[model samples]
Target chain A: MSETNSPSPMRILYIEDNPLIAFHVEQMIEDLGHVFAGSLDSFAELQKQFASLEMDGALVDIDLADGATGPQAAAWLQERGIPAIFVTGQRQVAAEHGDVSLGTITKPVSSSELAAKLELFR
Target chain B: MNTIEDKSLPALDQVLILAPYRKDADYLGRLLAEHEINVRAGARIDDLARMLHPSPGVLVATHEALTPDALATVAAHLETQPSWAEMPIVVLLDRASRPDQVRAELGRVWPRARLLFYQRPVTAVELVSGVQSALLVRLRQRDVRDHIAQEVELRRELNHRVKNILASVTSIFEMTRRGATSIDAFADDFRGRLGALDKVHSAVFHSEGDTVSIAEIAELTFDPYRLSGMDRIVANGPPVTLSREAGTTLALCLHELTTNAIKYGALSHPDGRVQFAWNLSQDETPELAISWKESGGPDVEEPSRAGYGTRYVRSALAGMFGQKPVIAFEADGLRCEARGVFSRVAGNQ
Candidate 1:
């Protein structure tokens, strides 16, 4: 997908409770040459708007505004045929729910690393 | 030395009586009831075994109540007693029976029980006093159990809070790094964000309840700016309290706004000024409305793209308020406003 004739940009949704982090990640997603599908702070919010959210993939944090509902959100997204990547500082928590995501990207995520992970959706 | 009436002590006033004779059981129950002690009596070994689950304060038995089956049942119950417990057993001996023989037999069968003996001709006053003392010991044992439970609960809560704080710090660190242009910039911004988080944490910690006042959060967030004596920022709001989570979110949002203002908005110029205010409504669904308006700065033009601070202000407030906040980069200055159900943000209902 990194070749000259690469696939179109993926629409990536972010699930994070911290707004600053979410916005920063949104910018990073755009920097990686992908579409920022938007962000949700909790799994409950995701569930409420699941039908309306247009995304090709997801970046999920282990914790959310509604406590630890990120894992459930990933599972819910996976069930809907939407792929997800765990983007969080909590590697242990992400590892525990690893099956739902393509891979894990630890926090303080780099642009290059995020660019590489976005290929999983392609 | 504490008495049974001490409110802090657990109430161990229930007496369990095992007597094969109906008259004896009835008399004992009536006597204990007169002293305002709750009493339960059983005339059979099976009945006694069935009533042993709650582990009454004291067990009183007649001489004939010590059938082999009853002894085994009582032994089994005492075996399961917690290390802190020693179920007190009072045995009423017939005057003709050998007291030492009966005491030795009971001691062998019920190893951990505190044994009290009363001869058949004993006075009611003496029996009641013996039972009361036994109940007091039971109450003390209960106190120990309660203390252990409370300690365990507190430890669990402390661990949970520590984990949450660490996670919040990690998020702040990662996001700050993402937006930094240089090492010095990263360190400065990171430190400021951490300081903001730490301030809100302490404020919430010191709050009497699990909620902090909105004014308290705003005051703390803007305190450093106020200390610089620039005096360009103004903040005023009604008395509104927020849950610990809501307080943390609001504090971080304010931090983002203040930093942005200092860097590129109203606070960027000497003559620039900012107004921060909020109001509570009394409609069917009570709402809280907040606005941040900047003016008198250099001619503001909408950036070709949204910056980290602007994006955070929009998304964070949206997540917290459950609605998208309006952010307008006007020709003169920046304006941001949002509103949401007050009870939901406060987490009161």
Candidate 2:
């Protein structure tokens, strides 16, 4: 791994039930010169760990281990002044709660798209 | 008269009377009311238009009420009705009226209506029975409508599940490819994971409430190892059902553990043994604890490099239980255990 090209380094937390997808995205965030915070599966887990979680941005999936509570988790983060982006296959679901998110990056995410969207964290 | 239901659109139990002759309309309406049947009587063409919107169970119209405007309104309403609905209409004709010609004309005008004709001097018993019969048929049509709606909802639910499964497979494929050292290794890993997923799906589908018991998952997960002319794995647990998500995560984790054991742990040797068990602690929170222990195999030492199986077991269990699992590579064999609140993954609540 080489350095000296990143503009800003941000720790990104991902909320997804599928660990495989989470792992892939974890590597993607690292590849983009950003730090991977951690992965939580449900909104319930998010609430429990919210106060202690250190992250500049959050990536969430519309459906989680608990159910379809991704939009609610994003709103929870938004209320605390922390920004979030929805990385999900359920684009319509993400759009319905678009006000709580910076934007959406559809699933089977490419590095270029994620890197660009993470830039909107500020 | 009192109304049974205030539905603006009439239900299958209400009758509508369209008679131009006020006397005839009053007579029919009074007769139906005496039978305790709901009746809506209208004389003007405007009233007929308004009444048509509230699809009545049976329409009682006098021969004189079949004016061009009245016929057009009924015909238009019938045209827009759902395929399952055929509006019932009862027409009172003069005794001298040519029955055959009237029947043919009415059939052509209201193509989808169930038309029943009665002579002018018809008896009360006969008219009442006829209307009762028509209402019965309408009730059955309503049942059909409800059944169709339920089926549509079931189809939507099935479609949603199919999409979620596809997304899961895509994730598995990409992740398995990431750690593959060779093409053969990739195929074997993908096939094994997919089989575990498919078997868990079957277990969940067969179980009531879309939940699979921990015992069933163990039986299915450990069946292959037991079938190979030896019973090296012993699984024991009380009846504890988990939601589809939790059951799937558990099943896949078991697969990774079992395969690792066969490849490098207890099951790798001829005299090897594996013990799998789970318990719910008696407490306010009722934390569920599951453990896998092995012995009588080659000396176990932590591998310097962790592959997809080890990494997935850690990440998936942590996500599912809201707690990370402990994996120990002891001298005898490998041991793994995780404990979390029972309520978090309980099914059908």
Candidate 3:
């Protein structure tokens, strides 16, 4: 909580398939005093722009535009020393890939829950 | 129908006559042919096995034709028959042959066959009628096989549809809860969104095939407002049909827009108004254009950051149309417009 209160906010990238849910979660992320680092619909797109994306953490959904690649994307991010969390409706899927993320925030995500889980990234 | 025929069971109207004696083969083939019953003769045991490849409707065999080799070949063919098939074998016995012994031996050899026994010097009328009845039974079995296949296909389609609907409901619940401010607000908004989804689902289901008209989507979205007698919102468009996916997306988008309007934009004030219109171009590469405009409301100003409604409109439209939509927050109103290839938006009709 102290780290979140610092002058600079954490930049969080979103990986989700549905645009409506992504946008809704984007606003929630920003409302929790974090910066929205933009969103990618699939793991392939994230790979394409992984180098240029300036983000401190990532919020991933289990399903993506290109199918079930979110867990793989989180693993890829973890390999780069970037912190990630599962922001998905599929709890079972997230639990299966639990080792790759800080924690799971089930959808529809609440403001307080998101604000609390984001502390782990700090 | 042509594809059905291509994969259908073999033509089952013909009768195979296994009469090793040349005179008997000629006489029987001629008699059956005169009665309009197609007949093929097997002069050797090898010919009987070869003819079984394209199974005949019935087999007419003379007692003399029942050599051990011929009987074995027929038994093998009967064993390989599909569960839907029961090859009809009509055996003509010689008067000197013990009928009971032959019947018992034949029954043991052909376990699943329909055996019709006729004594020698039998009437043409009785033999022809028996063969005709056997052919009718084969047709009934074919119908049952076809019906079972159709039911299997329908069950698969139904399972797929049920899974998709459950996923959709999950998405709606998640998204609705994300934007609620209070418990009461959450309940109301969730119910409204679910109602919208349910309405659109039924519209698509009842429509011919997997498509629905644009007008139907618009009407359902605005029905609540219209029933409340606040006819300030007006939507007009050509009769454009959309795939189930496209129609559902549009319906949800309109729901978001309608809710936003009532909360902050045109529909929030008595003097305000909103206009929604769309048209399809006739160019070589046909395109569809849709616009939403709000006016006569309190002075408008862009929020410091896009809210859920505005953000959803841009992102969802971009995904559906493969192009970014133009959304402007002017001093007097909010305006949004988007255009894309007609085929892309409508999907493969």
Better of 1 and 2 by DockQ: 2
**Could you tell me how far off, in angstroms, the CA of residue B54 lies in candidate 2 after the best superposition?**
4.5
**Which candidate leads the pack in TM-score?**
2
Docking verdict class for candidate 3: incorrect
List candidate 3 segments past 4 Å from native: A1-122, B1-133, B347-349
Which digits, one per residue and each the tens of the lDDT, describe model 2 over residues B170-207? Answer: 88887788778899999999999999999999999898
Q: All models: lDDT?
A: 0.83, 0.86, 0.81
Error of 3 at B132 (Å): 5.0
Which candidate comes out best when scored by DockQ? 2
lDDT of candidate 3 vs native? 0.81
Q: Arrange candidates, best TM-score first.
A: 2, 1, 3
How do the residues B262-318 of candidate 3 rate in per-residue lDDT, one tens digit apiece? 888988889989899989999998898888898888888889977656777886776
| Least accurate 10 contiguous residues by lDDT in model 2 chain B | B1-10
Tens-digit per-residue lDDT, A76-113, candidate 2? 99999889999998899999999999999998887778
C-alpha positional error of residue B187 in candidate 1 after TM-score superposition, expressed in Å: 1.8
List fnat per candidate, in order: 0.39, 0.43, 0.30
- Candidate 1 lDDT over B1-349, as tens digits, reads 2222345543555899999999999999898888877788764777777788777788999998999999999999999877878888889999899999998989999999999999988899999888888888887787877677677767987986776677667667777776688999999998988888889889988985777888898889888888998688888988888888778888888898899889888889999999989999989899999999999988898989776677777877877787889999888799999999887678353
Count clashing residue pairs per candidate.
0, 0, 0
Query: Which parts of model 1 have CA positions greater than 4 angstroms off?
Result: A1-47, A55-122, B1-13, B34-36, B46-50, B66-76, B83-86, B93-117, B129-133, B136-140, B347-349
